[model samples]
Target: MEQVPGGPERQSSTSGLPSCYRHPGVETGISCTRCERPICPQCMVSASVGFHCPECVRGGSGSGHSASASRPRTVAGGSVAADPRLITKILIGINLAVFIAVQVVGNRLLDDLALVGRWPPAPFPATQGVAEGEWYRLLTSVFLHQQFWHIGFNMLSLWWIGAPLEAALGRARYIALYLLSGLAGSALTYLVASPTQASLGASGAVFGLLGATAVLLRRLNYDMRPVIALLVINLIFTFTFSGIAWQAHIGGLVAGIAIAIAMIHAPRERRVLVQYGACALVLVATVGMVVARTAMLT
Candidate 1:
């Protein structure tokens, strides 16, 4: 029998699974996005699009140098940043600023920004809502919170879940995911919630981050118990609590899981296309839902 170079005999197992290049006995479904070499979770360094083996990440010395070794990327194919949590910090700052503005300006700012399917209730003129073309509210409401405890809890969750996600997905992708998740939440609320009832808060986006964290951890083959417990508890709380917009929680979570799956599992061959395309699709769905709900309300 002739030995083949860089062939099945060197990289695959008799069980029909590809063996990790560095650990021949270990089978892995993941491969280095740069080199396409099988890599177990232990050897799977997160790349901008997928996982990478240690060799590709380290690059070669002299004439064998590789691009990745010079400019490393995140699991979503985004350039690695010096401060991994920079995006998270910016997001928290924006939320805090809005919270402060609301506190200073009072219900006027809140009324102007809150997600209301309809405004002024039944007896008054229906002047404010997504139905009235107040589309900015879908996004603005995501950062609006009236209570200290609400903003406090939300910002804490944002730091806890979003910082790691930013490091994994990069600034651009992380912010996109956060915004889309928030929009999805608002769209769902508009679609199903009472037209006169108003909703505002960052919980929708925070829940989205929580869902993304769970997906990322699962992809890395990490212990799932902790995230699962947290998700279950939050879901229970969302349903049991009064004045909570449960629709937003469910919508953002579903969107987060869908987007994260695309970001983590997209083939390296077409990573950018698949990842952004999935995001575009989610955005389209969100817009469609909002449009449909607006039409119904108006």
Candidate 2:
């Protein structure tokens, strides 16, 4: 949503402390220089004059006149958000929560969620795999992780990479890029990996973010060497590591690059449609892969 500043003053809570405009439960004394709304540390963006809320930093003149009329847009033409990193933070929270659930519930949770092409050797009821119609695994596996180091590396990469991309592309576009990329990865794994081989983790989504970051940096005419080198190192790890799901990483990377190009390069006139249409196309392709794979497995 487009954040408009300088609206009629909002009321403070019963505690007499104004909450951060973005995060309403958190009380804060700090206020945005332009909008004058209370801002917590997370919502605070340092400006030339003083601290401003994310919305004020992104748009709005301090004078409060024509603020709505002059609202700024991100590089991709998405509205500037009140919290640039909100989606990224929430994603991290969800992954962490899922990881904790897996730990407490043990392998059963992993069994139910991880992507499996066929699952359960013959003689077992064909009741537990993607081919047998447990299609949610394609998306669910994107968040499933068993090892500490795996989730740690993935979440760290996600925060480092995803936050900026989220700000640049806006929440709607960024999330589509992430989830679709992950699904692309899962689809590829299902298409290629052993039917009974289970795979799960956020690496696919994180790789997608990494790929999107590379595209965004190139779009902004920023230095390419750093991201290129990072990609090289990660690719080496993907191929060299014994247990890594290279298919998912590579699949997600390709999809992310494709989606990012559409998001940032679509003609301004047809931007939203082109951007989201690209996502829909990717989704259809992934579903196609699942259908073909299911038919083969069945």
Candidate 3:
């Protein structure tokens, strides 16, 4: 088969002088904003600034590259759309799946995953609930829920808070803030709740998103009155409700604030590292708290 010297072996439907940088067979006039290399539509990612090839996008993310921050993100889902809010959707899905599994498996799944404040046997406690050496409950409990109303309310709040926050912070930071906040909540529950208490739900993570949005709003010079009102109302409800883990709510809010502080203030040159460092510190602190609590219990 004969080939075009600088282009495809077969004539491409795309009309352009140069072929895609990676796909020599596909002709395209579109060039990457960063590297200025020609790219076909399929090879290009839409960025805040302009179109970019996958390689340039990857290269731009770190190593002090400025252009990468605006790169259109393709996340875990199939296609990344404008305002995808992919992380938020994923979190909701996982929670809903676990909720359904609870109905099917008869709360058995929660036994292994829910946060329990005590180390040993507590009658009527979920059989596999957190005990000594079951450290993973600190994070896993965020997904377990028994009541339909409980999961529904939490998922609604997550949809409201997470969509915008995920869009604003992007997927990675948003996820970090959420999971770390959940860990902080679990650690606090371990420290403060009755030894027999068993807690489960995504409230901790949802509160984390609220706190992050509050911080972001404050940092951006937006009026914080609404956020304050929301927090106050939520706290009131937390106190009013029986069986609610207010400790988790408070812990998650504080952790979220701490993480968002680093995210909102991080310098563009070191944003990823600074944000990740802040999250790591939160995780470390939560672990330290857990260890101290365990020592006291033992």
Candidate 4:
């Protein structure tokens, strides 16, 4: 609490003691420009930028103050901020791990891993004696990939699209969209594809991300023409490319678009209950359609 030089010393705001211990009796209305600590007039010195406390001005704490305090908050609403990179890393890790496990364990472990086909056949058919249930595939098929390239492309697209979309939508909302969209995509795929053929991959979920992006970009007042063009190009590729599951893609896209619309157009401050309820409704309707379609096929 030694005085530096300019005006009358003032008492510390925290300490009611008389005459700035730093600068006696010189009223320095100016507080520490760095820590906002009370600075006596004499102890307060003006730098090129602003007033600084003697300790800060001498200690050189001013330059780094903003930098340390500028870090973004990592948590909100009881959840940590979802880093897009983390999502991509997780997805890649899961897919790669599953792929390695599949190769190591062989197809014999299909039933154990719940990889059996559902009501509609997946890209890989269920082995003999394995139970076939639609609901099972809804979750299982997500981890099953037909080929290296199948998973490669899906994970790549997921990283590219999923990260940005997830970052914008938040972890919870993004996750909800991803899972629900995948299910929606599968439902549509089941509705349209032949029961004899099985399908699988995160393509539907990626497509959902695409749909979500298209909706989000529009919401953020960004130009969506490019996104539309991309969608068109991808759709065209789906039709032209052999073995591509266009039904799943379209299903995921539609589901994503619907979800995005609900998320973006709803009130500025969304009621989680309402948003989740709407999502549930869409999921129920999508599943109902799938069931109806499957029954018809039978």
The candidate, 1 or 4, that scores higher on TM-score is 1
lDDT per residue for candidate 2 within 1-298, as digits (tens), equals 0000104354477767777767677655677767688765445444434455656654653554333324445656666687889999999999999999999998889889888887576778677889988999989899888888878988889998998788778788889999999999999999988788889987878888889888877864555888999999999888876777788998899899999999877887788899989998989999999999999977
Candidate 1 lDDT score relative to the true structure: 0.80
Global lDDT of model 3: 0.72
Clashing residue pairs in candidate 2 (N, C-alpha, C atoms within 3 angstroms): none
Best by TM-score: 1
Off by over 4 Å in 4: 1-84, 108-134
Give the top-scoring candidate (lDDT): 1
- Candidate 3 residues 185-246, lDDT tens each? 88888887765677888888888889988986775455578899999999999988677888
Instruction: Give lDDT tens digits, candidate 1, residues 200-293.
Output: 8888888888898899889776568889999999999898877788999988998998898888778888988999999999999999999898
Off by over 4 Å in 3: 1-83, 119-131
TM-score of each: 0.81, 0.78, 0.71, 0.65
Q: What is the overall TM-score of model 2 with all chains considered together?
A: 0.78
By lDDT: ranked, best first: 1, 2, 3, 4
lDDT of 4 by residue, 1-298 (tens): 0000113334543434344435455333446556665553234344433445545644544445532221221111112242435655776688678777877886544434322223224455444211344466655566666467777888878887886565555567777888888878777766666554456677788888899888866754555788899889988888887777787788888888888777655653454655677689878977796668756744
List of clashing residue pairs for candidate 3: 111-128
* Candidate 1 positional error at 98, Å: 0.8
Backbone clash count for every predicted candidate, in the order shown: 7, 0, 1, 10
